[model samples]
Target: MPAILLLIVSGFYVGNTVLAEYVEKEAVKVPLEAYLKGHETGKPEYMQKAFHTDGKLMFIRDGNYTTIEFKDYIGRMNGQPAKDEANRKRYIESVDISGNAAVGKIVLDYPNARFVDYMSLLKIDGEWKIVNKTFNVEPKNSSD
Candidate 1:
């Protein structure tokens, strides 16, 4: 009887742990989905919802390392979809979470180039917000 009770308790603990992790993962996806919505709609409001007020994006441009404030980056969006929006594809590739910190991978496949973004996120005041982003772009040839 004691062994059966122990087994039941262990099962309960394992179930709770798995449920907690699933809940956390879903919570983390909230901000990531917002980020994707921003790209889909070309709206800064969505981006603002996804990132912290002081977030920034880092990448290499013209052979020089460059960083842009999230606000500035969103400001460049004209609230209009790209001309080739129909041909552009974007998605969250993966997300890994540990306590209050998490990281996400995103892919932006454009007609001319493919971009892979790594975003660092944190849970602040019970909300997950992207704190930083770094990405690399690969150009594609028309023939390929």
Candidate 2:
């Protein structure tokens, strides 16, 4: 009887752990989806919803390292989709979470270039927000 009780308790614990992890993963996707929506719609408000106020994006541009505050980046959005928006494809490739922190890999395939972005996120005040982003772009003609 004791052995059976132990087995039942163990099963419950494992089930709860798996359920919790699944919930966290789904929660992490919320911000990532918002980020993708921002790019698709050319709406800065969606970006703001995904990023923390102090977040920043870093990348190499013209052989120089460049960093832009999230606010500045959002400001650059003209609230109009690109002329070739129909051809643009954006998606979250993967997301990994540990405790209250998470990382997401995003891919943006454009007519001219492909961008791979790594975003770091933190769960603060019971909400997840992207805190930093770094990405690399490859020209469409580049050899894979």
Q: Which runs of model 1 end up more than 4 angstroms from their true locations?
A: none
Candidate 2 segments whose C-alpha is farther than 4 A from its true place: 142-144
Candidates' lDDT values, in order? 0.95, 0.95
lDDT tens readout by residue for model 1, 1-144:
999999999999999999999999999999999999899889999999999999999999999999999989989988878889999999989999999999999999999999999999999999999999999999999975
lDDT of 2 at 17: 98
Clashing pairs in 1: none
Please state the error at residue 44 of candidate 1 in Å.
Answer: 0.8
Q: Each prediction's TM-score against the native?
A: 0.96, 0.93
By TM-score, who's the top model here? Answer: 1
lDDT of 2 by residue, 1-144 (tens): 999999999999999999999999999999999999999889999999999999999999999999999999999999888899998999899999988999999999998899999999999999999999999999987443
Q: Give the TM-score of candidate 2.
A: 0.93
**How much does candidate 1 score in TM-score?**
0.96
